[model samples]
Target: MQLSFLNLASNNLSGKVPDCWARWPYIVGVNLGNNHFTRILQTSMSSLPLLEMLNLRNNSFSGNLPSFLKNGSSLVSLDLGENQFSGMIPSWVGQSLSNLKILVLRSNKFSGPIPHQICNMSVLQILDLAHNELTGYVPKCVNHLSAMLVINNSLESYIYFPVSGGQLLVEPLLLKERVYDYSSNLGLITSIDFSNNELSGEIPTELTGLKRLHFLNLSNNHFIGQIPQNIGNMESLETMDFSRNHLTGTQIQSFEASSFVGNYDLYGPPLNNSCSSNSSSNKEEVHHVKGINWFFVSMAFGFIVGFWAVVGPLLYSSSWRYAYFQFIDRMWYKLQYRCYW
Candidate 1:
């Protein structure tokens, strides 16, 4: 029977998504995750031109990404994590599906550079490309993610049925290190997970511009260099993991050892390694402080000597001291007489 929503998740269902889905022209949501399905996804998926959400996580779907998704302009959430899908993530992902807000491809065999063209998806908020063999530096254009740069508390990413005018079924979101179904508050979640890959290079400083980002995971990679100096600028960050990489820096606040474990070059609080530079710098500062103290002492001594030199002869000579006091007293009496008269 034709349906607008189909959910067969966590079942014994196997093999490819049925060819019958093509007949469901009104289909808006499809979930077949956690199954034993194998082999290639049918190109018939192109038949459902209005398909909005597709979940194939924890399946055995293999081979290169099917270009059939190019026709799925209405797609907003696509999850293919924990699969065997290989090959580069298509550039068309950002070119065609501009409305997509959530994209997950974790634990896949996909490799090659993450296309900078994907930065074109201004509305994409949650992106998980971890647990892959992907190599190359992260795209510096990450600041282009406009949706993640702002706090969204609405349900703008929800799927809606065209005919009924009612909201469609909710989709699963992997957030805060777990999977949860987000129904009415999907827009509030913003995160990026690119850990456990061969991705190398410095973490882009531009990523700190994602002020509304709530979670970030860049652990278990080949990243080098210090963590971005302004990483604390991500004020909305609630959870982050940068462990098992080659990162070098002092311990970041609000993070624990697990977040930086396996990173030998990093030091400071939360890590057993102390920053020896801190001690040496303190010693140098002590010498500078001592020099400043002696300079102040010399200024005070010179002022005292100069003051006594000018007044010592007047005090020793009784006649000069009497004359000086008499002059001061005469001036004071004259000023008082002028005021009273």
Candidate 2:
């Protein structure tokens, strides 16, 4: 049977995916998504030498992804999203999927830094791996994929490019030309939505080099420090959201207020207040105020001492000295003599 298309979507298919499908050499596309299939994808699928498209999304598959397609040169589109797959994406995916145009592995449980070797795929058009546990800085090689579209963790929406004949002819020259056009516009990159993960540290300033960046989302993560001021240099940026982070300092004036909603420490615009009041002026003012306080205190202390000395003898007889005692005694004797005469 020359099967061109076979879709077994939303089936209750249980257990591992059977390897018998590889016997059909003429099968161009196969989809076994949305099933209860358990265990990792078998390595035997790579034997299908003529397979062009494959989809095994929304399954219970677990463990490190098998690099079965390391030598499959004919695959153009591959989707393994929404599975239980874990560990780093195999490095060979980039090395072997040179002819691949669309690749998707979003909504999986995969963790680890994005592989730098992904730049080797010069023919990749659309790449999506959003909503995973992936961390670390975005690979610089991501700029090479010019024809990428719908790079999101949520796979609800997609970009569709209609083929003229309702089916692609699969010409090698046309494929080469498409790859060449993609590589030529290497700077026309796709959106990278790494938000809602555990990614930390400052925003990589190197990402500003992507001249054709249209969408950027780094929200709801552990990223700290100020947003890179050089982000304004990305002239083609149409949408950017860095909310729910620890971004501080002033962002470029061009960014809208909504772009920085959840960053509590961030302030807008530069302050005009002079922080340069002369040091000498401040010193003199402080000295003058101190001197006035000291003078009033000294005068008050002196007045208290003088008043106490003058009034003490009158208040207490024992406080009277010899001179004051003799004068009082002579006055008393004269008064007695005048009364007797």
Candidate 3:
């Protein structure tokens, strides 16, 4: 008996992917994604020459690249994202899979320099190698990928296949910060994602020549130097992210703590959102302002004392009031006598 397709994805299937897969010589597509499946030993595996699409993403599969995949010349789409797979990616992947259009190794533990041989895949439309520990330079020959340089209006940007269960299967990839399956006439959607890696060195200037490339993400990496001035040549570019990179070197190092050290009013992280300096100084100023407000008090006290000293006797004593009236009368009589004379 021969099987044409096998898709048991997103089913919570556990344990190892059975070695029985090696027996399916006639199989065309295999999708066992989003499951809890464990390691598949190299000894039990064999090459399936007819295999076109193999998706084993989001699994517990570990160890190096599967040896059987070295002969996957018929493979068009291969996704192995969010797995525990470790070690260096083999160079033969570029030498073998010339027919590959999409290759996704996102969120894996892959380390070491990306094999520059991948620049040979002339027909590759999407290449995702993000969230890994990969280092070294992105090959200057990246623009040699001929598919990214051209635009085809009649082609669909995503990969979709008819499963054995008589249903359509769409391969998922990261596009515009989202993780979803896109199935439509996406209009020459070519992407290059090397984000979340330790990759260093300047971005290749030849990357600007890819006129039809749709999405480009090199975020969270150690990429340095200026962005290519000819980037505007990418006429069909819709989404491009260079955030969290070392493009201009350190993102926050130049801002320095000294620039904000005395910013007592500023509040936030690296500053802990607590203005202790402002709070302490503000409390001391409250007391200082309070103690310095004695001028009004002294004015009122002097006014009360002066008013009583001059007019208290007139109000409180009759004898003193009569003497004050007599003195005024004598001054008035003396003034009239002098005027009459």
Best by TM-score: 1
Candidate 2's displacement at residue 29, Å, is 1.9
> What does the lDDT come to for candidate 3?
0.76
The worst-scoring run of ten residues by lDDT in candidate 2 lies at 170-179
Measured with C-alpha atoms, the lDDT of residue 103 in candidate 2 is 72
lDDT: worst 10-residue window of model 3: 249-258
Clashing pairs in 2: 125-148
- State, as a TM-score between 0 and 1, how close model 2 is to the true structure: 0.60
Clash totals in order: 0, 1, 0
The candidates, ranked best first by lDDT, are 1, 3, 2
The parts of candidate 3 lying over 4 Å away from their true place are 43-45, 154-168, 249-341
Stretches of model 2 off by over 4 angstroms after superposition: 40-43, 144-189, 233-236, 252-258, 269-341
Off by over 4 Å in 1: 154-184, 277-341
Q: Which lDDT tens digits does candidate 3 get at residues 1-341? A: 78888888899899876777667788888888989999776643356878888889999999887888887898888888889888998898889988788888988999999998898998898899999999998989888888898776653444455455433354656864687554453224688999889998988999998998988878777666866767888887876766656443112222233323333344344444355755677688888887677767888899999999979989999999999999999999999999999
lDDT of 2 by residue, 117-191 (tens): 776776564456666787786676665654442233232222221222234322111110122233323223455
Alpha-carbon RMSD of each model: 21.9, 18.0, 18.5
The lDDT of each candidate is 0.82, 0.66, 0.76
Q: Whole-model lDDT, candidate 2?
A: 0.66
